[model samples]
Target chain A: MTSGTTISGRPGISAEEFGYLAGGPGRAAEVAVVRLLEGGLLRISREGVVSAVASGAAGAGTPLEAYALGAARTGRMLGDLVKSTATSEAASALRQHLVDRGLVVSDARRKTWSTVRVLCFVAFFAAIALTIVFRVHFGVAIGVAVVALLLRWFAGRMRRPVRRAGRREVGRVKVAAGDRVGMVAQMGLLGRVGQFPRMYYVWEMLGIVPSAGATLRRRKPVRNSGDTGTMYGSSCNSCSSCSSGCGADNSGCGSGSSCGSSGDSGSSCSSGSSCGSSCGGGGGD
Target chain B: MGVLDKLGVGIGWRPEIDLTVERLPGVDFVEVVAENLHVEHLPESILLLRERGVPVLPHAVSLSLGSADPVEPDRVEHLGAVAEALGAPLVSDHVCFVRAGGLDSGHLMPVPRTRDALDVLVANVKTAQANLPVPLALENIAALLEWPDGELTEGQFLAELVERTDCHLLIDVANLHANALNLGTDPNRFLDEIPLERLAYVHVAGGVEHNGVYHDTHAHAVRPEVLELLGELRSRVDPPGVLLERDDNYPSDTELAGELAAIRGVLARHA
Candidate 1:
């Protein structure tokens, strides 16, 4: 998912250098380049400007070549201009390949880790309870609590970085071409601001996407999805915004509907409703 | 009256409407999803509420106290940790089972009203209470369907459970309305049957009617009938506080304020 030149099989200038011609990493721009390379449909000049090969597979005047040539001329990286944007597909493909070759661990390991973590917690608490029952002394209780807390804290610290590393395996490059160019250009103008753009993905994961007020507004579509009547999508999204409302990233969605169904409080106790411990913030009605 | 008596109108501190909630002109306290909050990294909004001295109740949804299986000690420990971290005086969860036989229903499924279910719920509640750092109040859930083997009325079941466990009640008037509307039961009769003194706080929420069945979805606006039910409950027993719960389709700040105002108005008239 890096915006760099890691298209392992491709020859000639790396994707980053080709991106330099269009200004930066993008979906449509990457698709055009890959198509050109695959079908030998375009000739990339020594100067990095891309031009249609007269006997190209897509021919000179075709929409694909025209778009590629246009991107080359204007230094624009088209991302998501057409339905065939390959960024997501490429990321998934690469991820699967890595998993297949054992370069990356399979998702089943993550599940095992999670289950083990929960069991660790259960064992830790059970020990604490046993200590309290057996010792029945204030000093013993304090010592046990302090030691347990420290152990839990250390365990959490150790797990977080590794979990984050595992997560990066699936983190796709979602940056658009224009934004990428703007990011590069603005890096100098905004000293530490350069680090800020890279943090966008992380911040978005945290649901605190800075300057995404409009993006939040566009999320109205979520409210209208099939789960709208049940308030599943919006509630879960809101719950996730509540600092990882449920346990896993998407677990909130499943429990969001569950929280609202006849079983829990149906809607009230689900992520946002104030029904129970997982009540998103709203009282369970 | 308990410490909750001094507290007044408040709303659930939903992250989606955190800004709207934070800006409320007057609020006694706010409740947060216990599972959503991490003890070490609490939401900034929740921290601000604590800084402002607004009580934050950690409401849990997955405890599944009535499940046949023993409650997870880890889950109870997590709840205890959250309560301690937030300095909450009390915490709350539902009286229904969320998972059974190792399969999570993903919803609060109803426990049978039989004596066997009652014994299981009482034992689970006692275990949860022992693990919790503060008092645990359990709320009754709104069920779309009832178990066939029910041997007691909902009120009688709650009354007996509370009597046995010495637990408090987080009564949801909206749930009462839903049950009354869908189950053909009298909400007033329900109010009369429950122990009024056990009321910790009252919960009011909104739901929709679909195909003649009232669904307590908490996604829609709080219907007037729910407010009326709250009024009726207040008349019978002035609960320590009333919290307005709005889960989704969150309206503008003005509308939320209006809902809070309406709740306050109801409390005022009853008072």
Candidate 2:
């Protein structure tokens, strides 16, 4: 649920600003903001900050729903100081999770266009496959492959050419394709950085016991209740190091997680561990 | 010789403890988490297992065979690659789903012990078997929750699965103990329900006490209750080997050696 705010000319608004926008603080505004944020019905940004690229409930049925869910989880983590991943890192984690799940999130306004692009990609692949099945002549097979690759390239290019529309859904906030793609890409990268955090979740899910390194020792219990009251607490405060050591924004406690730091910062994979490597960088394992 | 042929014990593979496993004398065979597989970067210990003639069988988590959705062919294909690499005698997965169409419960969820699930599981097992290099075995996981529409008892569910798929069993005695303690089901009756002849091995692990309920934590050495059940199974099933699973507070080789002494004492006295 999201809080609602009525802008003189806008449609969807964030819960954070809904209380201020509706001229008074109330439950409806808080709800409107949360629902809008959860459903990604808003696009947020400041004068110099990158736009808050959330969309409205209109994109619920599209692939962007995955992105929205990630955003919501990130937002909740943001609200809860759930150690590891800065708000931005969390946003990226949410984005990459959606991508790994095969959901390609884009601006809601460009939904129909992406749908067409996917269809063109499919049609191109189908042609190539069919040519192989039909035992097309060598010359013809090469032609089909070329045509299919070209069509795929064309579809990818079209993914970038969406006209910039100034229509603001979340109060005067206008969203665009570039912002959308950039957000999706940023999330993808962040998702990789979120590996340790997610690895935590996966082991928890599989009932696999975790590796308790010297770092995890002496963890104080921070329940979901620890949303505020302290700008920082626990391991982060005791050591001013970001708890995440991955990424953290200045606004949150320092647990080492900065939205911008990367886990693959200096480490490089060995040649055998490459894409064709056994760890299944290609998932063959 | 294989782990079964040697100390006749089943050991958990901790990539970190590979060298210790080789240098130490008592470990039988290691039940490698298919995740144990860093195919390209085989832990120096796995190579040692090979050098020392230790068998390392794989236990997988993501078969997702019992899902309502169609099984992904690539999953089995990848599993086959692991199976092919290890040449494990039996590849096992939890009796649960990893994902559904639009959701992931993120736990080893239990399936209803119904005819429908039986058919689904068998089909999934057959599919995995067709692609895998060895026979596929199914393990009985410690289920914390039950299906509202379950059609069979946990033992009956397992017996039928073994019958249908011809899959061997890696019955976790600790799991059965937890099931008994958690569900308040009698362990003797549960034991009588399944055919013990299909059991190739057994798993014993430690559990935690939460709200007066026992949960499989695998943190400590095998608890006393599970050891008791293992004693019972030793009398009845005469399973091949007993594996010790300690995932959390992995003691040093010396610490584990002490635990192994306790296990070998039981296995030997019974023999």
lDDT, candidate 2, B1-271, per-residue tens: 1323333775787644444456567677888788547566655556667667777788888888888876778777766677667666667787778788868888788887889988998898878877888777678888887777888888898898888888877788899888888877777777788888777788888888789788898876678778888887777866777888876544555656776777777776666
- The residue ranges of model 1 lying beyond 4 angstroms of the native Cα positions read A1-285
lDDT of 1 by residue, B1-271 (tens): 4567666888998765565577778988898889988889887678778999999888999899999888899999999999998888889999899897778898888889999999999999999998897999999888888889789999999999989999999999998888888877788878888898988898999899999999888778899999998889877877887898977555556667888999989888987
All DockQ scores: 0.01, 0.01
Candidate 2 lDDT tens digits, A1-285: 222232222354332222111111111122222333333343221111111222232443222233333443323321121122122332333323422333222334224444655576676667677777986676776676677666644543333211112111212443233332211111111112236455322112222123211111111221221121111111122112222211111112223232111111211111100100000000000
Chain B alone: TM-score in each candidate?
Answer: 0.98, 0.92
| Highest-scoring model, lDDT | 1
Chain A only: list TM-scores of all candidates: 0.30, 0.24
Docking class of 2: incorrect
Residue A83 accuracy (lDDT) in model 2: 21
Candidate 2 Cα deviation (angstroms), residue B137:
1.3
Cα TM-score of candidate 2:
0.48
